[model samples]
Target chain A: MSTTLGRISHGAGLILVLCFTLFPFYWMVSSSFKDQADILASPPVWFFTPTLANYADIFADEKVFGAIVNSLIVATLTTALSVLLGAPAAYALARFEFRGKSDLWFWFISNRMISPIVLALPVYLLAVQLRMLDTYLVLVLIYLTFNLPIVVWICTDQFRSIPSEIEQAARLDGADQFTIFRKIYVPLGLPGIAVSAIFSFIFSWNELLYALVLTRRSVQTAPVMATSFMSGYELPWGKIMATGTLIVLPVTIFALLVSRHMVRGLTMGATK
Target chain B: MRKGGEFVERTETRLNPGYGRWTPFWFLAPAVFALLAIGIYPMLSALVTSFRRYNITRPREGFPFIGFENYANVLSDQTFWQSLGLTARFFVTVLPFQLLFGICIALLLHRPGLGMLRSLARVSLVVPLATTYAVVGLIGRLIFNRDFGVANQFLNAIGIGGMDWLGSPTGAFIAIAVMDIWQWTPFCALIFLAGLSMVPVEIEEAARLETSSKVALLRHVQLPYLLPGLTAMLILRSADILKLFDMVFVMTRGGPGAATDLVSIYIQRVGFRVFDMGTASAQAILLLIMTIILSRLYIRLIYKEIE
Candidate 1:
């Protein structure tokens, strides 16, 4: 009887936790379909006449399409630059012995620890001086400090997992360093590169501070754009939720699709 | 034959002379350059700017050297101290619950015979982890809304009085903390699950056979394996919570008499909103110092464990 009670309690607890976890997401989605009156109605509307007006108003008035393009451009550039630069460094760290090797590795890892808040002022000042404000280039470059370290760190582990003999054999067959990297290492390290790329893209896509500071009108990201919807007079609840859902949709989809890979990549070298 | 072989070896050595020694640098050069230009240069510039009084509005004078005056001002400022206290409170209050929930969920998911449920659980939990802070802030705002919110409705249903979530100091702080917990608990759980997987089954089975109690098995076998993960989660989450900005900025904008204002939010306001660049830079430097100290303590503790 005690064991049966224990089992029943456990099952109930699981259901409660699941509900608690999923309710916010459900609310967000439900409220997105709600009109302003429906949203502000007392006692909260669970089932509502779903409307596409919020989404339509968001797209029509908010210029979210432009923000999406900006996000895509910035994320793409950041990912490409991070991977192109980071993969080679990761390979060097993994395969080759050199002076200050451990120091170099630690230095890269420590870069991740440096808060972006510290660098914000200088980056702002620099952006103004260079006249790179509101450009995709500046945001991508600013994102590199955080993203590159992660890429190199993740890729280093991936490269180290591959045997050195494979690269050596390729080199022995008159393959140049670049050739061996392209033919052997790149193929082996593709998954790591994919994980690193996804992380870089997500970080850039979600970034708000630099986007807020640097861009005034032209290069605002989705997050910054979403913030502009807030006025002291009246909060546009429907539009904000609609835009919020749109902003998260891409990363959410990407995350769900590549979740298994992300889990493996993140957990790499973490257990031991 | 020996002489011919020796000559061939000599030729091979000369042909490949120092190739291995120089190859790594060639590969590392691009990443190193990027890091230096983007990472190190900006940091050094910030360090220099912290010591100088510069207003972007007044560009003609060019950042006059202030010689610790900004630091002195920031040190004495009561608001700064309050912000620091608020940040500390935020960190201490939220971290313990996040850790506990994370561990409990990880344990639940780690149980055998939950095949498809486990994957579904992971997917559902990880959705919040992938969501951006801006969206999270919006969600929190909606959930904690005074009149139309689901939270107040639930409270009313349970016969509890509805309180203003973002209108008061404690309410606003709790709202922000709850949002953070919602967003980050899954991350902590993932880390704990990874750590738990490393726990040996034999030890757990042995403990179970001996004691036949779940608490006994966890205490004797699983807890030791979980310590590293717990330490890591604590250190990482503490560092991140100290730097909390996006949610606070979105939800309350540090309102209700600056009660919810954290150090990072304060720095942003002083720096950007007020355009007190030197004061802001000094505040940032102070924050950086505190973070470095905490990180060092964490590293030392982790190293002690390893040793």
Candidate 2:
């Protein structure tokens, strides 16, 4: 009886947790398809004729297309740049010993702790002075504040995890250090590096404060554009929900694709 | 780990002959340079700006040196203090529930048997984690809408009246916290799951045989092993929750009053709205110090063993 009760309670608890996790998303997606009146209906219209008007209206705005393009370009460039710079640094940190090695590692990792707001003011000011505002380059560079550290940190662990014997055997066969590094370690560390890339992409994609402060109408990202709906005189609940859904869909799909890796990526490879 | 280090050291010695000392430097230089340019340079500028009067809006009056005035002004400002207090309240309110529920849910999902249910729960949980903070805030607004939100409808169905979630101060605060908890509890659970998986099954089974109580097993067997993950999660989450801006900006815009105002929003307002760069920089510096101190504390406490 007790074991059965335990099983029953366990099943109930799982359902409860699942609901808490998913209900808001359900509301978001459902309301995106809802008409304005049905969205505000008191009994909460569980059954209604779904509409695509919100999605239609959002897509019709040229600014919305600009935002999506900007988001994609910024996130992709940031990921690419971070990996380019950070992987070699991580490899060096992992493979070589030098004076201040620990200190350098700590410094790189500690960069993650610096609040985005702390950097926002000066970066914004610098962007204005340099006439770099509303440009993809500025956002991509600023995103390095978080992305580079994550790439270096996670990739260092990745490099460290590869058995040294494999690399040593290559070295014994007269493979140069650079060739061995490029040929051997890069392929082995790709999984962890990919995880790091995902994190950087998602952060840059979802970033708002910097995007909001730095960009004008021309370069506004989707997330920043999504907030413009909130400040408008009319609520535009359907459109807002629609935009929110769009903003969330790409990353949600990406997260699900890497669901198995989510646990490791999120913990920054600490737990593993 | 030491063997790998030694192997690298030997390789460096072989590769460079006499100047292996400088080998890693070449690899590290670019990353460090980039950090200095983007991260350190801006920080140093903010530090300098904090000590001077430099409002972009008032460009006619050039940025002049004003030693400690900005810091003094921020210290004396009641709104600044209130926002700081509210930030603390927000952190205190949200983190515990997230930690508690996270652990509970993690424990539930960590249970050995239920195969498909466990997989489904884990997958569903991380959906919120994938969504942006701003979108989560927008979702919160819809869910906690005074009239037709799903939350109120659910409450009404269960015979409770709708509450003004974002209207009043307390309600707004709770609403924000709830939103945070909902979004992040899954995060905490995932981290905990990762930690739980590290525990030796033998230890758990042994503890279980010794004591029929789950709490006892967790306390005597699991908690000790889970400390590192807990500390890591705590550090990660604390750093994040302290810097929360996008959520509050979208949900309440720091509120109907200054009810839900946090330091991030406060600094943004002073910097942008009022164009008081000096005060904003001062506040930012202060926030930076607090963040460093708190993070250092978490790191030292939790990471002492590794060091």
Candidate 3:
């Protein structure tokens, strides 16, 4: 009786939480499929004749396609650069003991705490002066800085978790430090690096404030493009929902691909 | 674990020719240089701007050095204080609910015999986290629509009747809080789930023999393991609330008569909208100081074990 009650209560609780959490996503996606008439229905249409009109409308605008491409380029490069730059620092911090190493570690982690608004204002001015505004290069650079901390933080944990005997054995066996890092740590630490990369990609992809302030027309990202729908008077409910669905689709799939690492990644290795 | 690595490194330094003294510095240089350039340069510029009269709107004014005046102006502004106060209130109100719901859901998912359901539920939970803040804000606009929204529809179903959600101050504030809870609670649950995983199966089984009450089990066996995660979650969540911009900006543009003017939105307007770099930089600096204090505390908690 107790076990059965436990099962039932836990099962019921999970369902309720899932419903509450998934409801908005359901509304977003269903509204995206609804036609103009059903989209604005007062009772909130639970069923409707699905239409491709919203998708067609969004795709017709060349800017939407451009925004997606921009988002992809920015997110991909940011992930690549963040991992590349951060891994070595993490490895050093993990394996080597140098003076002020703790301070260095603290500095990298603390960098994550600085407000984006604080950086965005100055970076915006500098970008304008350098004519770097709205370029993928500028966005990637800014994102790299923001993402570096997570990469360093998680990968440090990953590198540390590896048995230090491996390093000692590799050194005894006539392996160079870089080679050992490349041969052993890289393969072993790939999971943590990948986690950090996922975070970098997602953060850069979804980021709005920087893209909103910096990019105007040519280099606008997907999130920025989605917000543009609201500035217009009519509020294009169908198109907004459709755009939101498309913007969220890629990241959702990407996140699910590595859901196992997500708990560790989400907390930045603080827990797991 | 580190002792072995340190010994290996010491051997490399004395015995191996390949283990150069500058190896670590070389490895760390590119990232360090990049972070310093990106982090410090902009901060220094902002610091300089805060004490000067630099409004981008009037370039002719030429960014003159006016000592502490910008700070004074921001200090005197009613909107600045009110927006900061409102954001603090938002954080205070939202954190506990997110924590409660998150812990409750995490408990459910962490229960014994929740094998397949846990994985599926956890994956679906990522959908909300993966959704961008701006998209969430857009969804907020739809969900809280006074005319045809799900919020009012649900309220009406429960005999509360339809009410304007984004048009009134209290309603709009609640709407922001609701959306924040919706987005973050899953995150809290995920963190707590990880924390729960830390409890040894043997210890838990032993504890189960002593107590049938889930509450007691959690209070005694579970909550202890949850502290580190709880601290991390609280710090990250509060910081995210302070820096919240995209959602509130998209939902109401900090409107309904300044009802949802969270600090970031307020700063966005001052810095971006008005091009008042002086006052905006000062406001930004103020936020930075507060963040520094909190993060310093969090750093101690997070690095306690690793160091």
* DockQ of every candidate structure: 0.54, 0.67, 0.69
Cα displacement (angstroms), candidate 2, residue B113, comes to: 1.5
Which pairs of residues clash in candidate 3, taking residues 3 or more apart in a chain or in different chains? none
Most accurate candidate by DockQ: 3
Which scores higher on TM-score, 1 or 3?
3
For candidate 3 chain B, the 10 contiguous residues with the lowest summed lDDT are B12-21
The residue-by-residue lDDT of candidate 1 on B131-220, one tens digit each, is 888778888888998988888999899999888998988888888988888888887777777777888878666777899777777777
Q: Spell out the clash pairs found in candidate 2.
A: none
Candidate 1 Cα misplacement greater than 4 A, ranges:
A1-7, A260-269, B1-18, B59-62, B294-307
Better of 1 and 2 by lDDT: 2
Off by over 4 Å in 2: B1-19, B302-307
Best by lDDT: 3
TM-score of each: 0.93, 0.95, 0.95
Candidate 3 CAPRI classification by DockQ:
medium
Report, for every candidate in turn, its global Cα lDDT versus the true structure: 0.80, 0.86, 0.88
Candidate 1 lDDT over A1-272, as tens digits, reads 98777566656556656775677777888888999999999889888899999998877874788898888888999899999999999998887666898668766765655666787888888988999988888888989988888899889878988877786676667787777778988999998888888888887888777788878788889998888776666687888888888888889887776675554433323344
| All candidates: interface RMSD | 2.8, 2.0, 1.7
